[model samples]
Target: MPWSDHAIWWHVYPLGFLGAEPAALPPDSAPRHRLPVLADWLDHLVGLGCNGLALGPVFASETHGYDTVDHFRVDPRLGTEDDLVRLVEEARSRGVHVLLDGVFNHVGRSFAPFADVVRHGSASSYADWFVPEGDDFRTFEGHGHLVALDHASPAVVDHVTDVMDHWLARGVSGWRLDAAYAVPQAFWRTVSDRVRARHPEAWLCGEVIHGDYTSYVTEGGLDSVTQYELWKAIWSSLNDVNPHELAWSLTRHSALLDVFAPQTFVGNHDVTRIASRLREPRHLAHALTVLFTVGGVPSVYAGDERGRQGVKEERVGGDDAIRPAFPDSPSGLGPEGLDVQRLHQTLIGVRRRHPWLVRARPRPHTVDDTVLAYTLHDPDSGAAVAVALNYGGEAATATVPAAAWEPAAGDATPAAGDGSVSLPPYGWCVATAPTLPS
Candidate 1:
């Protein structure tokens, strides 16, 4: 599949974004049909310059969408399968691609096959679909209600592949394989090969938080994996007032670019909102500056562009705060959020204008405890973008290594003659070398 290097994704956790009940509704309860409401935000997302909608789990599950009860059906609380199809069509009409979260590593204890295993014991044909510990089945990350799937089972592979086929047939452009590291690499290779065979343009990214990301994209047959390391560095460095931390992480980021593009973001459904996570709120601009200028496909969590604040803790309902509901339409959003939204728009606009940045890697120009500067240059076209960040109380000065550069984005102003630039307290700037005449 050919990946859209230029894609800017807006990730939404639909279960929370739609204000759906946390627990599964009773069988007799009426369907809420909140999926259609997302259709109303298509224009808002397009206006933000996002061409991709990376939705969190939308499948039928027992509690949260991760505890899948059925891979083939859409959760009734959200809506019918038809609702998703209509939403996909609406998004496509606005020139946006839809990516679905595929949770194949685990299923709810109530999943049909697992329930059958529980009832019929070893006698059940589907018994091998799960791994048993003593008389109990293994669960995902110790969550007993979330039963882990036995990836080696042929039936399991068939069921998952068929689910992909069903959704792709309905217009899903790609799949974000959840808990991909938990499943064996061979299983992903088999499923990815089958999916690509059927839908050649299908993009597959894995939810791999740790381990050699290059191996998963190469041997494991994934196009990309989540860049959690850089995400942590972005917030942590700002909170600690340590730009060297970000510099070290960017060096590692540059190494990974040699392998494949990663799925990058500052906030997501599982983590604390970046606005609250940063010790200094004003650093939000610097954090987003890194997100947009870096070499990867970036995703904006639903409320992040609006500077929403929520802290994700380890207790029950920890994620609820981070994944709050949005109003039905943009008009309902408050006026106070417009500033943050405009910041996101400006940064994303810079990325759209310089699409080559998707492949461009950073070369460090300067690195210090409170200041970091680097240039994202394309060796092929000689195109370069210089980024400078200052996290100090006093204004800092940085010199661009390039012979000459012009301000492309940010609040810092460049000195007229020299390659020097002056950054105000907690300021940043993005500059690009002039292109030669074609």
Candidate 2:
């Protein structure tokens, strides 16, 4: 089967979410067996209406689960392969798909093959597996600890293909290819084709920060790519008080739908928390309104719905703040957290009820520095939903086309005697009209 058209994703950075040590401990250190901790949150995810769990790096690694040391083994810090088996089985039982992070672009300095190259130098049989720069090997973006793999090498290709097959057999629904933009597009086509040959239902999404996303999905054989361009526009536009910026990005976002849907989100493991990034916390609802109502499969970063705050920085240990551990259950949440969680549940309900929003195109009615009004419609069914937002301190009104006007979601209500709606400061609304007969 193809991926569910209405997949609602909940992303978690496992190592950080479970509070694993920042650095890898010695081999003799007792295993933490933290994989089961996530099992405790499966119900929480289901309660939030999420159908997919997008886990960050979880394989054996030197640190942070990114510089992978072994593809076949689960990180000792997390647990044994049995733990992964149990987690996947549990998630599946709850009707949630699990997407593993595939860090194919590089390996930890300690990866056995790379270790052999380090020890034997030119005589190592694996010397050809990595990019050689004079007497040294190339690293991922200058991080000496993250050694880049040579995609040109047949051995590397086979290894990656084997890793993917191994996990898919263990019940992983798909892969979220890490740093995929850094790898050659042809390599992905080869890998994707190989994997799909055996498991045609598998879903493959890439971590593409910048570039033509259309090419990555259509030409590179990926099902989707991270929508970072739209991500940046969401927060930046709100901070700069420029709704037109969001309008332009949405226009581009609509064009991308003509090719394939991108993976959409407001906050993720790699960036600062949305609450911390926005100038005013109230604007959070407006940002989320656009995320869910716009086209694409959407993901909620772990803890974002709880109003978590963290700022990502470039210095050592900078990521620790954003990737903090979560308590094992919902009862642990504070009062404000419970409120945020309720908001997420309600908003996600709106998306789930209108799965066609996945392919709906945005039709803008108004755009200004602090106000935006648009409608998302299913062309084939004539089903439509109107969205209005006001980011300024005072309330604002937006006129909706008579045919598009309908019952609004949240606090928004119809304006008597006018085809318009009123929005409070930092407020937004989602309204749906009856489908016009085709």
Candidate 3:
């Protein structure tokens, strides 16, 4: 879909980024290819300007790959199915973009049709594929091994539309879905209208979190969803210096960018490490400059561009500290993670030179409780950018009504003629302004 308006992603969790064996290997072991260790880091994910990878679960799970237990196999502890078709043909020969991670509303009670309905319970024939309860089934939020499926089963909508048309015909260009708000928004509008009538540029995205993400993307014919409320208002308003709680979630993220671009993130693989949820890790470049100047389809997570910290606690291997383990490549990392991987390759090369900031819509121009300021326009290419943050401790000045501005990427300064920007205490910026009149 217009190549997801230039998707950024780099997410990765492939069984703890290739360390595998957190427990699931024994359906007759011996196939541990470790997904070509992410096809040897696809040129370290295209030198970090992330053209999208976003994986996380590789099916056939019973452990953390979202407990799938075979959506047509492959988690033979992460190998086979020709090592994920040569890691999606070597991440589509370096132009990356993969996405996966489905987990259709629960399965993992040894999911061979819920272990044949726990050894023929309702005289199993996959007994309506789950959700019984008294005779025992409905688990998932209580996590009794996660069973609950049967989203008004039409054989669970032709087995999730033949496992999403057998993995988007084995190439994978999208699909995050996972507990998409406990399924059923008319079963994801009938499996996203039968997987976009045959992979019409796949890209599903759902893991909703809280409700009404624009009626789950117009009644679940979704194309994107997990903006987890601007990822908890950018790390709880920069760990409470509170730029008016990220200016009221960028005014509800500009009303969900008038209805779609929502896949944004800060530190994913289920939270904590934005360099250990910053209390002021120099505002981690003000949360990657409000995640590369707003709008959406952003990703990054894999060891969060190497500022890796990890926390995510709840119990039992608490997401093994935000999904750890990686280092079979990218020249075996660590030199304090290459200055946060060159500050995520300079803010993903300023979000790949502003690919229309993927629907630009922030507009605040100064909100307080420690300096904010915004802009982001692109109404059909009147290209604009202007951002600023600055959880105070001294020097500040973020003006932004955009009369003129330039600097284009952090360590803020631009003050030539009244667009004001000067922020020094925990500073930030993203400049390149001018378009402010409509």
My TM-score estimates for the predictions, one after another, are: 0.97, 0.96, 0.37
**Model 2 lDDT-worst window of ten:** 410-419
Candidate 3 lDDT tens digits, 1-438 = 389879888888889878888778875778888788788887887887887888888887878888787888888888888788778878888888788888888878777777887787889888887877685778888878778788897998899889888988989887888879988798999889888888888889899888788887898788888888888888888888888988888888888888779888887888888888887778887888788778888888887777888889988988898888887887777577688788779877877877888777887878877898888777775767788888978888878764566776778755767778878888887877546555
In order, what lDDT does every prediction score? 0.88, 0.87, 0.82
- Residue 240 in candidate 1, Cα distance off native in Å: 1.2
Q: What lDDT does model 2 reach? A: 0.87
Residue 165 error, candidate 1, Å: 1.2
Q: Considering lDDT, where higher is better, how would the candidates rank from best to worst?
A: 1, 2, 3
lDDT of 3: 0.82
Best by TM-score: 1
What tens-digit string does per-residue lDDT give for candidate 1 at 176-236? Answer: 9999989999999999998889998888999999988888988888889999999999999
Clash list (residue pairs), candidate 3: 60-70, 61-69
Q: Which stretches of candidate 1 lie over 4 Å from their true place?
A: 1-3, 435-438
Q: What are the per-residue Cα lDDT tens digits for candidate 2 across 1-438?
A: 146567889999999988888778797877789999888898989999999999998898988888999999888888889999999999999999999999999999999999999899879999889988876789899898899999998888889899999999999999999999999998999899999998788889999999889888777899999999999999999888789999999999999988888899999998999999999888888888888899898999999989899999999888989999877776676676777788888888888878888877798887876788888777766777888888788888886666645554666854535548788877787888765323
- In Å, residue 119's CA in model 2 sits off its true spot by 1.7
